[model samples]
Target: MSHSTVSIIAQCKAAGLRRTKALELLIDTLLASPRPMTLAELSEHDNLNTQCDRATVFRLLQRLTDKGIVRRLGLHERAAYFTLLLTGRHQDFLICTDCGKIEAINAQCPVHALEKEIAQKSGFTGLYHELEFFGTCPKCSV
Candidate 1:
C-alpha cells in the first residue's frame, strides 16, 4: 500500500522510534518505490543523500528489519533488495531480472501439508516459508 508522510510518522511512533529527517526521507522513498530497492538504489535517491550515507542507510534498514517494517529479498547474485511491509501482508514475489521489477504474489501455501509432515518427522517447531520466482518480465521478454 502506498503511504503518506503522516502515516509514516505514525508508523515510526508505533515502532517505538522517534521521527527524524533522515528516517522521514527513507520512509518516503521506500513507500513511493515501485519495487524492492537495494542499498545502492537507496543511496542514489536524491532525497536520502543530503544527510544520509551508506552507514546511515544500513542502520535504518537494519532497525526497520528488526521491527518487521521491511523484508529483504535475495535476488540471484545481485545485491539484496528491501521492500517495505507497511501493509502487513506476507507475500512472495515474481522478480523480473531484466527490468528489476518486484511484484508481490499473494501468499498461498503450496507446501502446507509437506511442512506439517516434515515438522512431525523431523521434530522441528515453528516452520515457516518464503518463495521467489525470477525471470524476464513480459515487458523485457518482448
Candidate 2:
C-alpha cells in the first residue's frame, strides 16, 4: 500500500474505526484525486463504485469527517466537496462560478492572524479557517 493509504488506515484505526474494503477504497480514491470531490464524483469512481454503494460512501465520509480525517468544503454549488485533511497543510480555493471549477491557492493565508486573534480573544483552541473566492473564469467571461 502507498504511504498515504497506510497513514489513512492508521488514522482510521486511531479514530476507533475498523478497517474495511469500502473504507480503504474510499481513502484511496480521495488520495488519488487532485482536488476536493463531491459525493457524485466519489460515487462514480470506477473502483469505488464497483465495491460499495453510495450510501456506504456517504457513511464512511461522515465518519471520517467526524474524526477530522476528512473535511467538507461548502461551495456555492448544491453538492458539498470533501478532501483528506493532511497534517500541517492548509489551503484556500479559487472557484469559477460559471463552470464550478476549483483551483487551489498556494499562497500564504491572509486570515491566519485573524484566526489567531479570534482564538486568543475567545480562548478557543484548535482554530482554523476555510476560504473560497468565486469569480468567472476566462472562458466563462468570454
lDDT of 1 by residue, 26-118 (tens): 888987887788988898899887878989998888888788677888665667799777553446788888766777776685766887899
Q: Write the per-residue lDDT of candidate 2 for residues 1-142, one digit (tens) a residue.
A: 7898998899899999999999999999998888999888999899789899999999999999999999887654557789998877788988787777777888999999999999999999988877888888788999
TM-score of model 1 relative to the true fold?
A: 0.64
Identify the runs in model 2 with alpha carbons over 4 angstroms from their true place.
120-122
| Candidate 1: stretches off by over 4 Å | 1-3, 75-77, 88-91, 95-131, 134-142
RMSD of 1: 5.0
- TM-scores for every predicted model: 0.64, 0.80
Q: Candidate 1: count the clashes.
A: 0
